[model samples]
Target: MKQRNILISGLSLVLMTSVSSVAMAQCTATGTAAGFAPQYAPFAVGGALNTLVSSINAANTAFLTQSTAFVGSPANPKPDQEGGGIWARGIGGEINTKNTVSSTYALGGNGSTFQPVATPLTGGVNCNTTTNLQFAGTQVGTDMARLNWNGWNVHMGSMAGYLGARARDTTAATPGINAGGSLSNSLEVPFVGAYAAATYGSFFIDGQIRWDFYQNTINDPIQNGLFNQKIDARGLAFTANAGYNFQLGNNWFIEPSAGIVISQVKVDPLRATGTLLLTGAGSIPNTTTFSNIESYLARLSVRVGTTIVSDKMIWQPFVTASVYHDFAGAAKAAYSESNNPAFEALSFPLIQGNLTANNLGTYGQFALGIAGQVAGTGWLGYLRADYRTGDRIEGYSLNGGLRYQFTPDML
Candidate 1:
């Protein structure tokens, strides 16, 4: 009964949020010419940029933390550094079930551009930046299986050339911006880190550190061409997770995990230029930049699965329920413009009030996955489908990856 009540309450919260957010008051055009409107058009990009930085800095997934839950594969002691064979992960850090090399891609969006602003300032802007994500990583480990409590690995990943997303804004919706404006987004992010894990019976703990590099661009095709507007954000993160597995007869097991990702992002001052998209007759030089943003993401998850093993291979199927809390919402940007000497002098302040995105607060996630490995061999792979639903947000992420280990054992 309590679970049913909680589910009902969650549904109500999302429905109410959607209605109040999408319904925007139409703008009334009063001024004859484009005064402060053209300069403020890029504000929407600021909000999207904030969302991008926040997502990149966060580490909110915990399904893989139960590294000791494999059937027929008992928890082994940490590999010996001196026992020496080929060290796939180096001598400093040994490999456990968590060590692997793989690449995966996720394609989805965080609602749409028709989202709502936190406050009604200079018009209104709705911002979100979740179109797609790509990831490839390498973690090096050891072979001696003695790593019961003393195994670690170095991990590195990158999304060097990420795909772009589209944003739509109407002067009618945002008040002072152009009447009909379209935006194109291009973003790139790459991160590198090292992680270590310790196991005590069926319980395990892991921690990682990541250094992130971010660069983004917003294009106005009708106005100035590429690179006219740019976003700059770079940072680092610390992530930690703990999980314990409980066997339920036969090959079935249940695991619960919790994790947290704390990130610090610094926005370098951006100096970019743009033209007047509203009135095609004139040119207005503008500047766009954002203040530094810091955020933290917390996640809780439980997974149930059954494993099948054979002489040559192993297969496992699992389902997971997860919840995420992302505290990274505010987007603070500063904009200014210098009018052409021959053009009309600016009558209004272009640096309007604060702009925001729908990236903060709590959300829920569910995933179904299958994993396969060649018994006694060092190769394995998995594929997963994920759905995220939350207040003012909904999206999907599909992932598949393959990994290679240095050593393996079977029943």
Candidate 2:
């Protein structure tokens, strides 16, 4: 009887302990669910627990989808046994993509050779001149700049301030004179310029200005009478431009621009001889000086092309038309000198003359070229080559440069 009672008591005790353990386990699970819900989803309570759970799961999936689009990575925190994961990482202060800054610098030489129809003289006098001559030379130098913060699907910056030299020489041969007169002219011009632009979506607008100081000399004599004449010229020009760039498909874009250039030019011509034979030698000695100025210019341009292989490499072929209004002071001076008392008595014929006047009308220019990136941390470095033609001027220019990015972020 005693053994039976002991076994029964022990079994009762074991039963009670098992029941207590089950109850404790259930309480612990409920507590864990409550804690997670209150902290992560405070408003997701009441009888809508199932709906809340579904909504939370959808939001988590959406966040992961968006995050992976930028930096291929998995969502933080492991999923629970029920297959729903809680977002353990905070979305605060996180960047989806890193901003990029690019800078570039390039150097190159440009040259060209051409022959145009010569201007024919009417009376066919033995004036002795040449036609259909060829001329060519190169411009050597480097350009530099910088580009930055191009991440917002837009690009904006000022690519300006490049310094370089353009040296050109032309030679023409003419027969009929005692000795075939060969005329050679050379010019050296230094230029400094700047440009600014902004791009949004498929459209871009830009403007630029450049200043050139020119010095040129021509060594030619008409029938060995004029000797060699040297011209010292100085000028300042400002160009204002506005353009729109249109994107065509992938890697192709076309930009058409219109602008005006106002230029101030001064040309001083020095004669090789001083004495005026008609005025009796002593009246006029040697060295005659003539000066003139040109002040207004306007232009329009259209560029079409695309990038090669990469977004950093661009090739744009363009055509431009420009016109200038000649200033009058120089022309008036030349006329005065021709009708002077000494010149009239000596009967010295006027040879070549230039003057400033408003009657000068429109001129045209056509250019074709390619510009692209070379080497650098930014897109500021560029290499460009172009051929341009207009009234009294036709030639090819090559430009390359390096740019350093200073303030990429500007209001």
Q: Which has the greatest TM-score?
A: 1
Task: Give per-candidate clash totals.
Answer: 12, 24
Per-prediction TM-score: 0.64, 0.42
Window of ten residues with lowest summed lDDT in model 2: 15-24
Residues 84-201, candidate 1, lDDT per residue (tens digit)? Answer: 1121210011010000001111111112121122332233333222322222222233222233225432122221112122223211224344333344444454445555444454
lDDT of 2 at 301: 54
- Segments of candidate 2 deviating more than 4 angstroms: 1-183, 191-212, 221-231, 274-291, 308-368, 374-376, 379-385, 388-411
lDDT of 2 by residue, 270-320 (tens): 444332343233212222333334344344555555555333332333333
- Candidate models: Cα lDDT each: 0.41, 0.27
Q: Which regions in candidate 1 have their CA more than 4 angstroms from the true location? A: 1-74, 77-146, 149-181, 223-230, 277-283, 339-353, 409-411
* Deviation of model 1 at 98, angstroms: 34
